[model samples]
Target: MTGTGQALWRRVPLWGVDASLVALSLLDAWINLYGEASPFMWASAALGCAGLFLRRRLPLAAFLLTLPMLVFMDVAVAPMVALYTVAAHTRNRLLLAGCALLNAAASTLVWPMSDTLSGEDRTWTLIQFVYTLATAFAPVLFGQLVQARQDVARQLVEVEEAREHESALYAQTVLARERAQLAREMHDVVSHQVSLIAVQAGALQVAAKDPQTRDGARAIRTLSVNTLDELRHMVTLLRASGGRATELTPQPTLAELQQLIANSGIETTLAGELPPGISTTAQRTIYRTVQEALTNVRKHAPGARAEVRLWHDTQHFGVTITNTAPTRPSVPLPSAHHGLIGLRERAELLDGTLTAEPTRQGGFTIELRAPTHPS
Candidate 1:
């Protein structure tokens, strides 16, 4: 059947199908005994038709119940359906063969007290028994075929799912290879040039006679060095190629805060200290918040003097970075403000909050607040 048709067929209640089978069996019984009024025969036929309802739950018992009708009345529907139900549910070939033989015998033989076979009658009875046996086996074979078809369908679905999963894994491997190639290019070409620029800037800072030239060269060297550190981290991540987590380098934490401030090239003062034993993730969040704040100060609030303050109470722990007004005229630089957005996301991951706003004193302040021990 087509997929939609099969789905609709399945939606038909199982009990309804059983009821329909019982009705068909009863109709067969009525047609066979149209003129007869034997109470024993009628009662056996009724019992056999009712037994169809139990076919799903008790296939063997339902088949047994139909045998009396097959022996006493000339009816085929009830016994055939019961045999099919047994074949579909069970895998024992011996049991199915025995049931088929019993069905054939019940239909072919007369009650011993009613009739006796002899001569030509005996020979015909033998042929009729063989014919009835073959007919009884028909439903059993069809039921087994249906059972095998369903098993094959289930296996096909499982194979398709496995194939899709393998394709996804192959795609991820290809992506990781491309990322590794890109990392190699950046390390060889970009890092080499940046190192040269930093070296040249350092020499210029040492040799220049003018104070402004010396300060400018020093700033360039500092920025280059910081850029190189970040590039190194990126290269390490790419080379790991989605391997084990331990293959990645250690992340920045509170211990590195002082070095970050010194390398920032901003006239930044550090104050206060957080209590010990904070989680590594929380420390990293705090570190990134301060890093983004300092970078913004250097870019947007040029020549601003900044202060980094760490604070912790019984309930919370965080860092606040506040800067004074720019000492010189600020330059208009293109920014997508993604750094602040990332900082805010990091704060949220720790169930915390980040606030960045322009102070009334013509400066900016970025503050991070998080629980001391987040659950």
Candidate 2:
């Protein structure tokens, strides 16, 4: 029963096999008495046949019904069949062993003792008794072992499936966070530049001079190219898959400081060399801080002069941006933009510190420092 046909046979309920086995056992027992059919034999036959009905559901109960009949006659047909079913189906080892002992005891006690009974006859009887007991007991223990192995296999499969599900959930969470980070970067760069371009275009349209118009057009062209390049770079990164594609775009570096200053509408100055060996994350953070500061400058204090400085030692990369206060009597206060809060969060996430305070010269200064060494 190891192939596909065996698998199909296991599912089939062989009612006929159970019936035939019960009937043959009873017929042999009746004929062994060597007389006309007696009422006890008829009663035993009916009990044996009826007991098979409960074989699948209640094997132990059927076995108990046949136990008493075994004491009356050496040959009991239904008891052995019912005991075999019990040993195969039941999970109780103790109960199966007890049933086997009872059958052996009955077989020994029921065999007639007469002058004709020889020593060899008793020895052969004992051998057959041992063989019957072995048959009755072995199946139960084997069944238990098989069931245990199956249970362990099922539990292992469940554990593997749970691990895979957890891994999938973690992957989804990481992908979602990366997408949000990309969106924030795009919004920061595009929004700031577009606002500046709109203002310059409007100013150029109203100007009476040709030189100012040409300058405005040039600034507009520069901003447009910068926006297009950033967009293209982001799209390429998003489309990339493997390790090689990751290094395709030129990474942002401190060398881009001059371009960052040129893009500012407010008058700005850069001082000192940016440190080497700075992480890409730190560089981007520095750029975003400066960008947001300049955006706030244009919105809060027009025509303001700002100074940006990069200073680094063996331990830290430091950045500071400070703007002079407006000359007019009424200077606009900084708006409630979420960009400053976002910068602070970004700094904290990188294990860095950011501080912003009003300067003694009636201006605001923002400073940030991050450690280069990993702990």
Candidate 3:
């Protein structure tokens, strides 16, 4: 049924209850053999029972209006039910107590005269009060108990909700700690090895007799230096406050940077297609190498011609980025020069290698090789 229809249906029982109260008023008087007093007793009974229709909307008013009528009316139960409604709905203890006292007082003053009163003429009305007053105020006591139980139930629900929220916050703290630990391990283990490679490569370039071998050593040294710079910056991010919060944003992919490189004014000569199922580690390493290479060219060799080559054979997939020396080396820019070092560490993690160095003609080159199927 619709809400309005359901509400009307619920009131149907209340209408019957109200009719019963009015009929009960007549029976209480007639059963007590209150002799033919005029229609005045009937009028009072009708008015007393009728007040119940407004008890929920105007409970205190309904009780006040009906209580006094019991002084003359034969209302057997309406005033007590109205008093219970007031007690349950009232939020203020002071107000509820006052209303309960008022109900007891009205009963003391009025019940002696009403046929709803079981108490008739007795020598000790005050002693009889101890017995009669209990019945009059019992509804208020029951309603207050009901209210107390409901309050406790609501408090339990609030406590449960608070505990769940605290548990979620604890879970987040543990996850951030794990990410920071991984960053620390990279710095302690892989960073040391890459640094050693850079130093050896620098030594080899100076000692080499052949032109091609010397050039390859120079390239490896350059790549190592850049990788160190990148690794340091990445570690800093992981250790910073709310570092994990930033990871939710997507990282760049090597396969998806056509526009990104083009917009940066690098004439990318991308060759073979990246293999279909390259791992996430490979993708990130390639993207970082290209990104760092372009950045280095922009800083040290402004307006340098650049080329990118991608190819993969049975055992390996590779990318090479080479750029001519800048036309204006005089243009000043700050360089931590560690991006390639970070990329090498990434490659090492995937059981791969990356090399970077300057060409004999004063151009820079970076090459990365990742396994087709990582162990």
Candidate 4:
């Protein structure tokens, strides 16, 4: 439905209740009482009850309009309900107290004990007076309670919305960081391979004698130039913005670890199988951890024997890479390299732990332990 239709639907029940109250007041003053009903008094009560229809939107007007009925009828419902509407909307304590006092005074005067009060009449009149005060005050207090409850519920909804918003922002920031890390890894791997190609191309251009061989060398150089241009473009795209896809191969998992070690040509022992139901995300983390550890070992400890161990129990999966001190040490890579830091962050995202430390045996060890299943 349209906005106006929805609003009208909400108001229909309120108006129906108001109409019911008016009808009930008329019937009570006329047909349902033990005393003889006066036509004037019954009409006054019905008119006052009509004010309930406007109480939600025009509370003060409804209260003032219905006040006369309280002065003329000994027991009434409409004025108390009208006073409740005003109290629910207004925050002024003095105004609420004054309205309650006025209704109580008018209600007490409507009784007949003011004339010729015997001892029994006086006692009954005092009890009636206390009852009148309770009637006048209870509705306003109840209205205030309703207002407080609604306020607390609204605040809870706002807090939940705020928490969700903060969570989204944190996820976006983590995604951006991961993208930058991937771009850096691609740059390092591609540049290393491209440098070797450039060196081979130069040797061909210098040594080739036949026309066909020279032409092939020139083509190889051109292809390398084009490849470098594309690499630069890919890196730019990866960093300039986020939440975009790139046509990259799927990440390696445990299946590729053997090829990784064989290609490294390092004498390393590999043991342990991945447990069932390990998440794809955790698999990628394990792959990257091993990759970074192997790269570090190759760079810093060229010919040292290394050991790779994998283990898992019902609750956890782990990887450990250890290498003896370098038989031949070389200058290390730049400190700004992100491999170890990315692995640490990757493990943390999975609620896992990664540790790289030197053992007392004069060797470095990298250990990673993560849950076997996603939480």
Candidate 1 C-alpha lDDT tens digits along 174-270: 6656777989998999999999999999999999999999999999999999999999988865754332233257878898999999999899999
Candidate 3 lDDT at 280 equals: 57
Q: Model-by-model lDDT, in order? A: 0.84, 0.66, 0.68, 0.72
Pairs clashing within candidate 1? none
TM agreement with the true structure for every prediction: 0.54, 0.40, 0.46, 0.50
Best by lDDT: 1
Per-residue C-alpha lDDT of model 2 across residues 32-120, encoded as one tens digit per residue: 55565467755765675577668878988887777656655556557767777776676577887898887776655543455115665
For model 1, give the 10-residue run with minimal summed lDDT. Answer: 239-248
Question: Which portions of model 1 show Cα errors greater than 4 Å?
Answer: 1-12, 35-37, 113-125, 202-218, 239-375
* TM-score rank order: 1, 4, 3, 2
> Per-residue alpha-carbon lDDT of model 3 for 88-146, expressed as tens digits?
77767787777766655565554435543445644354554555567656888877787
As for candidate 4, its clashing pairs are none
Which residue pairs overlap in candidate 2's backbone?
none
Global local distance difference test of model 1:
0.84
lDDT of 4 by residue, 162-271 (tens): 45533543554567678788779778899668767867886898899988888888788778878877887787545432221331446566878888888865788898
- Candidate structures ordered by lDDT, highest first: 1, 4, 3, 2
In candidate 4, stretches whose alpha carbon ends up further than 4 angstroms from where it belongs are 1-12, 29-43, 110-131, 195-211, 240-375
